[model samples]
Target: MTGLAPNVQLFPIESILDLVTDGVLAIDQRGYVLYANATAHQLLGRKELVGKNCGLPAAHGVGGTDLQLVRRGDMIWAQMRSLPIQWLEQAAYVITLTDITERKRAEENLRITAGVFDNSREAILITDSNNIIVDANPAFSHITGYSRLEVLGRNPSLLNSGRQDKQFYAEMWKTLNHQGAWRGEIWNRRKSGEVYAELLSISAIRDDSGNAQRYVAIFSDISYLKEHEAKLRHVAHYDALTGIPNRVLLADRIKQAIAHASRDRHKIAVCYLDLDGFKPINDSMGHETGDQVLIEVARRIEHSLRGGDTVARLGGDEFVVLLRLEKDHECLASLDRLLALISQPITLKGSSYKVGASIGVSIYPRDNGDADTLLRHADQAMYIAKQSGKNCFYIYDPLADLRIRSQNELFKSIRQALEHNQFEMHYQPKVHLRSKQLLGVEALIRWRHPTRGLLSPLEFLRPIENTELDILIGNWVIMTTLAQFDSWRRNGLEIEISINISAYHLESPGFAHNLRQQMALYDIPLGGLQIEVLETAALADIATVKNIIEQCRRFGVRFALDDFGTGYSSLSYLSRLPVDVLKIDQSFVKNMLEQQADKTIVQGIIALARAFDRQIVAEGVETEQQGEALLSMGCEIGQGYGIAKPMKAEQLQTWHQPAIEKTR
Candidate 1:
């Protein structure tokens, strides 16, 4: 106040103090506020302060302390400092309050970050922009077996295991430079010279201009996890007992081999091998010995093949081999070697045992099939080898397999046709050739195929012969023929109907019973329904067939011997079959005119039928001359396309009248 220039007016001390950022106040010894600056009023959120008690601890001398002050119902941190001062010549003190909320928060965050960096389980490493190791955490030392002092000032590449190529590091750096961070798994060497895997995350500490200044890396050791995963992978792809590839890995190998073979225009021989006489040995000996036998067999197979080739166990005494071959003979040679080696005696537990292998091979590109198809073909061929005297190898024939597959598909279609009522019956007329009189009609089956139209019995019947379908079709024909006879009788056309039963159906278990059940369904005229049994059928069980024929005769039904000369039965056996008529096979009848032997055979059948006192019908009488010749031979009854082609039931009623007029 004494240092003043002329004409200069000094501002009040309280007003000058309000200009400072810190809050200032003057208080009496009793703690009552005497003077307060504008900042103090703002900090305390009160406009008036004089004569008011400042609710705070008494100031001890002149010192600084942190305090919490209530401002507008909110608590805030402040640095409070006091100074002993004279206010209006009375005892008082001056206090200054500085808001330090932001500083306190920043200090607390630094403490937490420091604690985390010190105690984290994950290894942390910090490097400068030049990739020089600047600092490392305790976890880094623990995981890598390197002290912090040893790593400082060195390049991070010191931990490289040399497993990754330069290009790998180049790509990683490229990603880091573009994105400011990179996270991945890396293989590195520890300080102890041991290789290990780790999941690592690296971040670039950038400045305000987004330029990288430092790199922070955090990683966790995963060596034990990798080892565990490898073990699991092996279990999945390998057989536990034999240590060879299992079925799953075999499939993968075969697929890879097929790809390579197709690209290189080579061949792969897929062989399915099964141990012969192994089950007997396994049953007689203990299962432990059986297991040992299988193990030895696997080892022999593996040793017999080339290095590139693979042998896989398909469980239980079965194993598969895949050979990469350049020629046909290579596969043969390998297969021969395999058989020889497997047949060698094995000595285990001081006992000598022998086993032979039957190997079936399907070659790739030649078979032109996928992995699964090739495996299946080889398996089928293996069975063939087993049946043809074990201890041998056979090559799969695709052509033969194709034929079997076609037959199976045809059988399936026939079954579906029966279930969907796609089958129908047609009748071909049998007539007295000399008198041109209609004798009866033979019932034939036709399949109304959805896609291929109607099919003849010749197209579908042969494949199902001796199978259950044959019996089913034979039964269907009989029932259908009986129903047609009833329909004809209702229409005032009473005619005899005959049906051909296959050899299987005639000899089936319930043939007699099933036939009796069908006959009872309609009012069949005496001898109006005839069951024509193949001559071969009767020859199968002559006594059973004779008894069946005699039993049917009691029910007013007649039986005929169909395809007569084909079976070539003896005269003594022929006389014992009590059939009413004999029908010559079409093969002999159709070619009799062209072939002398056929003519002679046909003549012999006619003579035999007559000698036995049985009526004869000549099948396949296609020409008028053939029909005349058959009549001259004392065989008057005939059926053929020359007489009348097989027709539906509706067409037959209309066709019979015209046929009778033409014959007359």
Candidate 2:
């Protein structure tokens, strides 16, 4: 309608309305479609709209109104605006519809976001690129104790608790700048100057050009959680009764001490201490008094040590002390102080109570063990100290402990061997050296160890000596020897058999009865079975041994004094042992050919045997010259490697053939 250039072509009103982005439709007053643009038909998904009725509100509306249009089962929002117009001289209202679906959805999303920002529990803070606070949610004001009006335009550093250094913030900002986001725990101060912990997440709001325009931080206060976690950690690591470090913490301290000691080239002592009379005190007195006493004791011990030293309770009356020392002797002074301090009477509930501490110290580098091993060694030594006397400290000896452990392991192996029938008898011939006659055979025990092969009595027997296992093995040897004797007799090879018994077994109750019963089990002749007791063993209890030998003699079980010269028993006592045979110890016999002193000792033994009216046998004869020397010394019988090595029963049968022929 107005200033149009003649050169410009004028388009139809329909084409002009179709070019508009918004859908356009014209409805008459009767709600009939008067005109519809291409966009309106496409938006409504209808091909024909000229003759159809288009629903419109009968009102003169100045502002636009929203209307819902159904298209393919989907409701579409459209904005309608009405105006009075004349169509073909008829009075009607023209209604124009515009599709507003996408804009409405965006407005709804913004409303929901705004609601979330206002009601969220986590604090939200928005800052401009220059790090000035621009906006804050209500949660931010509640958590930081700062009002929105007071915090706006201020930096987040205003709430710094100073717990974190500048480098921490520098690193946080560095991460945020590089990664566009950062999340971690941080400590901050509230408006009331109270410090608190928070789990904070910060994100950089970046523009399309990859430049940060603002920063948004979301955080939750974690101070209460942090406090609760600290309480749990304390309860876990500290003893409730004594208020000292418990075993769990003690292990950590010991490891740290070990590491420091190794690095500094110093020493650390792990001391295990037990209150000697604590159990009685806890029983006689009430538990309250006992608890008080323990607390006092723990405090005293903790204060008595150096600053770096640690005292820990391993439950009950047991406590472990970790001492870092420059020298091992330094620990001794501290331990002595501990014993004295613990011995001092503790007064509780108007009653004076006295309890002593038995402390065992295992020094690092000296004990040369791990933390657990050191503690165990100290515990073992503590028992030793308790056994010796209360109120004392004992230093652990790893070598001696190792020896005891090895002996125990070997004892277990030996016991298992006996149970599994791994023991066998080896026979060494006792012969007349001058006549080359086989007199009898001494039964020597050999263990066919599963892993270690054949083991001599010297290898495994000594550990069992004086133990109940000694009695069991001794009985086994006697029974085994008698059984072999029966076997030989059945084979027409009647030979006397002798077995060595430990002192404990000989002194054991019912020894004579057990031996008599065992001998009766076989068909051997009277005095065919002999028991060789070591001279040292007989000296253990001379009267008991003499009585045992007499009891055996009554049952035709002869006795021999083995290793004759090894014991320190008086000659008078030796004369009353009631043994029928004297076997010279191997030490003198083995060296007699080369040494005059050994030869003289051997000769003296033979003379004593003869004077005592007993048979004499020289052991460990290894050469013909030695055997000849023994024969010259008037020792007629000998048992040694020079004669014949100890052989199994099966081999002995074959070996005896040559000796049998010689005897013939």
Candidate 3:
């Protein structure tokens, strides 16, 4: 049997395919079926399959049925393989039969499955191990607003927004391959042309060998969240009050601008603008007006800047503008335009208040190397402008540094001026026109510096006015004047004393109260105390000014419209005021004889005062001619060197008695 000789061996083998569900039959030559199994006998009936043809009718039910016989016109197809072969030393044909009905049914099922795959609602894509797409689902077209024809061979990047960088995609791929799935927020685009944010999950599919063959990504629209987040960021960065980016955003943006300028070898300008005279409007008129003015200020700032610039609110009357300039000259031009825009008058309630702003501009890459340094430099420059009498702008320079030190010393000296009793006031008399009687003495402030002997209101008042030190000096002027008047009252000289009021001093909420309190404390009758308001102050927030005047009026404290006819507003408005005197400006009186216009203005003021039934006094009668001209113009009350020089409290009687004797 080892390596057996084929001639000597008598080997037999049963049919190896007989166990299959198909019928097996053996046919010899002459097409006679010689061997047939149970399946074949049952399939080709006629009692046997020994003489069946290959295309035989299936005969069953133990009769000439379609399963077992090739009956007349009965047709059936069967699996049959045939060849001429020797079974027992005979030339014969051997054929086999197989029942293939189950296989056909299975093929039909596969066709149905293929139909479902093609019509699926969810996007279905089939790809090879090389990621070459072979099939796609219907939902792909519906969701992407594109037809399958357009996306058949394309990758998923057809929806890419480029919002994510390469590393973002690289990481995504790494995670998806390492794990089985990865989900994330992604920015993508639609075929019809819009970008959208999507929640996307990509899954890796592998073969039985565990090698990744394809990727499946499912995504949905998250565009709404993107829009909502944008809105939230805007709300966070911009000011609700003014609609400009707030200080927080301004700082960050300026830092960014500075960085860009540094990189590009360029320069930027930073301007710090704080509205002057804004607090008075808010404190006296109410914050409602203040907010309106702030909004208006924002509008003006936006209108003033170049298109390449940015303006932001650093909260409360403080605004900062950034100008990315191509050249230093452009920055200068921008600053000039900004100043002109801010200088225009803003009107409210039929009353116009024109306030100038102090703008401190710092040019960068030159002034400083960083944002914080530049902002500080600009802020320091603004302080210089305010110190130099305000309503101006200053560039921060080395010279400005010296001026800053000088201003510091000046402020320190002024602080001492108040702490010590270096501040004093003297009074000038007002005469009654008809009786030529001493009506009142207008209080004028002076400073007796410890070393500077004496300084007029012009010299030291600027410093006091620039600071809130006006409040302190204002109190001194009021208290000391009343105390001196009470001393005169003790001396049995019954004369009214009028004290000048700064708009800043009067607008203080405690001003009227303090005045009445001091009057009570000094035992000085309010009638013997008239308050003088400059024409400049008379024009500030007339309603509030009127209220202060009225409040003092209730205390029997009279008011005088100091320097009448010099203001820009109508004198008729002053008629509504409860003032008791009108002092002709010295300039008008000085040129009254030389200028016919001055005569007409003086006469008109005299007539206006007569109509208002108020006492009129003319200041600066330095010569007999000036005094005679005023007297001729029906301005009997005149106070100047001609009447009496401003004298000390003790010298008042000596100075006034001579004038009294001359008039009598």
Candidate 4:
């Protein structure tokens, strides 16, 4: 164990082997373990191995061969080297054993890592310092539709889509060189002659001196994801029904239009349009036909304007047009063409339907209104055009809309009165003309204005007609009438009461259902409640009114066409409307005795009602002579001051008692 001379014979073999760190083995030409050292016994897990044969092959010139050994039930690796040495001064072989379990484990891990690199799903590419692709994984070939042999030694530029410019590549390299990595979206071409988008990441493999030796790129195709994103973006900004810019995109477009107008010193005209007489078609033909009509309308409006102009549907049959104009006169021509185009006839389901647009224009910079205000002003103008006999366009006039806007206070007061129960229903008696018999009463709405005393519908109702206010006030009238009827029924006043329903309420989809709910809430008899709709309301959408009438009839409710002959009522259209009664307009009745033309009109209406087998009620009858004339003309029912003026619910009982007694 001390020291040995250069000659192996000068040292004890066992001592020399014990002093060495490696396992020393002596074997004959047949490879038997004749001499085993302490380290070899410990590594091989065997002690009595003096005659055991170690069958390990020869090592290649200083490079050791690997030998497997079992130690304490665990498999381990050892480096074995066979050397020709003097063993017991006879011909023999010496084997050196070195434990290399940790090194073998490192090599196994490297093999597994290489396998993962070749089999990953993401395309993998490796490039040398000269930017030549030295290796490509199977995934790279699958993604690019090329073989690894086809792409090896070629530059990655072969897959370039030519979408990235020289500057883009320069910036990419700059960032990659500085940060040691680069990741972003890129466009690349496939071997199948298709271009696609990909999310790519490149990492620099550096040498010990910090110089890049190779680059590893990993990428995934993201074309489908990008396509899905584009689809979502389109849906967000476009109307699914019409495939045009919706309200969301329209606002953004208007903002851009305004900015452009301001910079170029040009004016933009915002025109708000509404289709006249479209409701009846939609109500009659169903929503499918309605959708077809709307599509055609959109197409016509879009084609009617110049290329730069935009027409967007604001829902329903309403559309907004943006016209770029250099002068005020330009608006006239554009509006004229649009109106003409929209008024053209559209044929659907083998029937020709004609609808006209009422257009209201507000010029930017000239009107001094922003996008929202301009839209509102144009809407106001559109209402004027409709009131002025539609199928026309009108420029906005602030002075004209002043009175309309000024009614905002009165509107607020009406709403407050409704909320506070400051409104009342007045009952006007409709009586049998020949016998003075008590018939049903018409319920009229009256506002007890606190400051202005009692106000008739004529004073404030006209301002809110055809608006949501009308719908609100109409609902109030209905609920109040039902409650009043319930109270009257409790007191033995069993007369049917009819409440006038506005066009807005009559055309509402839930009108019949709402009425049934209210009737149920009040516990009133079904036939005890009657709905009086204006002749104009019925004309607005005949099919809708017919459906509402049919639905109400199912619940034992009756319908009466009020103020008949005041609208464009024809026998053909009237034949489609199902109602129980037709009330002659007061204008024709109030002066029928004084004016012969009024008398002829009333006679004709009475005759028409008789022909149609409809009960005729004369309104505004103020004299016994007028009642007698109506009776003579075959009109039996009369309502007005002559029959009985509209009286409070409390007065109704007392006023009806005398009429009942007189009828006896």
2 or 3: which has the higher TM-score?
Answer: 2
Predicted candidate 2 versus true structure: per-residue lDDT over 1-664, tens digit per residue = 1111124344477668777777665566777776767777877778777757756674657598888889879988988887777765666666667889988889999999888889999999999999999999999999999999999999999999999998999999999999999999999999999999999999999999999999999999999999999999999999999889999999989988888889999999999999989999899887998899999999999989888999999999999999999876688889989988998999876889999999998999988988998999999999999998888988999889989999888888878888999999999998888888788999999999888899898888877788888988888888888888898899988777898887788888998988778777888798888888776754466777788889989888888878878878736556887888888899998888779998888888888888889888888888888888887889888888988999999998899788778877
The Cα RMSD in angstroms, rounded to one decimal, for candidate 1 relative to the true structure is 4.5
Q: lDDT per residue, candidate 4, 503-619, as tens digits?
A: 778887698898888888887776777788787653466777788889999988888888888877655546887887888989999898889999999999888888888888899
Write down the worst ten-residue block by lDDT for model 4.
Answer: 1-10
Whose lDDT is higher: candidate 2's or candidate 3's?
2
Candidate with the greatest TM-score versus the true structure: 2
**By TM-score: ranked, best first:** 2, 1, 4, 3
User: Which residue pairs collide in model 2, if any?
Assistant: none
For model 3 the local lDDT of residue 633 reads 76
Whole-model lDDT values for every prediction: 0.87, 0.86, 0.74, 0.85
**Which 10 consecutive residues of model 2 have the lowest summed lDDT?**
1-10
Cand. 4 TM to true fold: 0.54
Report RMSD (Å) for each prediction in the order shown: 4.5, 4.4, 19.3, 13.8
Candidate 4 regions exceeding 4 Å error are 1-23, 26-75, 79-93, 98-103, 367-381, 394-664
